[model samples]
Target: MQIKQRHIEVFDAIMAAGSISRAATQLNLSQPAVSIALANLEKFIGFKLFQRDRGFFAPTREALLLQDEMAQGLLVLERITQRVTEIRAGSTGRVRIATNGAMAINFLPSLIAAYQHKHSDVNIDILVRSSRQIADWVSTKQIDIGLIDTPVPVAGLDAKFFNLECVCVMHRDDPISAQKSIAPPDLAGRSVVAITGQHMVDRQLDTLLSAADVTVEKHISSYYFAIARNIIASGGGVAIIDPTNGKADLNDGVVWRPFSPKIYHELALIRGSNQELGKAPAGLYNLIDRSLQSLIGIGNAGDSNE
Candidate 1:
């Protein structure tokens, strides 16, 4: 019979303890069991492992030669078992995440930092892609999690939705910065930095402006909220942006004011419909949920000068 784990275990114990009785005690087995295992190991290997002299069991030349290799092998096995336990506990592993531009720049990095503070062993991969691409990645299991604008363009993927009130972001030096809130008329004839594509926020802003008979110059436009905030910081003009981006740029020479009449930026946290999040990803997912809930709770509280 081939040498087995138990045989090697008993052999190592006897070599360390120097006696069958002590080896049995180390392994929590009867002396006969330890002795039997050692005998079988020696028989399988065709060599005597120990030189028994009365009570003392001295390691034979063959035993000494095998000791180092066996010890190294055992160490490898122990480490493998430990790593397995860590993986099963979600204490360590790689988490692949993808997101649209909104959360990718400022929000996700901070969230990831907080998660790594608690779970230092986890490896994280972050991908910045369009919401539709993120949805596709999540559905195909290319990513463990995805943060994207909703409604999720891809069906059959599990998605959690978050609705955030869009805020008007403007240069700190602008006169509108002093206002507690910005209404559609407040933007009339203003040089407006618009979000280029007519997405949800743009459509809503357009409807409000039209209803208010407001005509704002929209010569400057961008697709990403952070980029728009950058343009606004450079005195480019005002644009409605999500609160997450607003919060990220609190100290970036731009101010966020509540925009009326309450346009909401809908977001989705997505993952494969068929997959359950592992411990590390679940921890991050829960953290994101809590952070977004905190943002929603803040409401107009996101208004800040610095």
Candidate 2:
């Protein structure tokens, strides 16, 4: 025999409220209706679920066992109902996002703003970390989406190229900038300002420096972009940073020039290969594409290497 939902609801209600009268009030039914529903449920289960003495009802061991199962079933039903409601409204109850600190700080704010403009009811929780951490979070389903630096395989990730741009950064006018182009040896012995949070940028720079055999004095390892910008503006040292972070005018004394070694970063919108994009997240992802296209003066989003 098929157990109806009303049977489960009445059973759970009585177990929760511990009184037929209270269950009737919570279920918005007459006291007789709740009593009849529980009676029908007991008959279907082929056992008396409760023992009555005077006016009070006490649950039997079998009732307790059924209550445990019904509790879990009711929770699953509630979740299914909530999910259906959200889908009908064209939004998700929650969206978890992961991204590198640099992108989260500089880029994600605008993308989120654009998304909320249309789907304001959708909730967003942003996790900021290094690119490697973002990748791992996506893999583990801890985050629904990831925005990160690229050059990695997208085999197991549904990735969309967000943007690509040459690295341009600032430093106070020094002997290094006087030359039309900086040679690998020119960086030798000079103080270099690096950021701890921009992990991919640090790795790429380290690879280039290692290949060129350049040895420089490390001035500082900082997390704040403002501090890095300030250090370079105040003639503290040089910083290799993204153009997105180079918007403010520090001073005419500090000049932002393209680095001699041609290096670029690919920002990708990544999700699990098996996960399908919901309507709101897909719309937001498209908005991210539009914002990146505007920033880089590119007509389309695609891998430059391809």
C-alpha RMSD by candidate, in order: 1.9, 9.4
Say which candidate scores most in lDDT: 1
Off by over 4 Å in 2: 1-92, 151-155, 161-163, 171-189, 197-215, 223-227, 233-235, 248-255, 298-306
Backbone clash pairs for candidate 1 read: none
| Superposition error at 152 for model 2 (Å) | 4.8
Candidate 1 lDDT over 146-252, as tens digits, reads 98987889988987888988888888899988988889999989988878678889889989899999998989889898999999889898989888787664577
How high is each candidate's TM-score?
A: 0.93, 0.56
Instruction: Return the lDDT, model 2, position 226.
Output: 52
Q: Tens digit of lDDT per residue, candidate 2, span 59-131? A: 8999888777888888888888887886667666567888766566656786787677767778878887766
RMSD (Cα, Å) of model 2: 9.4
**For model 2, what is the C-alpha lDDT against the true structure?**
0.70
Lowest lDDT sum, 10 consecutive residues, model 2, at: 297-306
- Which one is best on TM-score? 1
Clashes of each: 0, 0
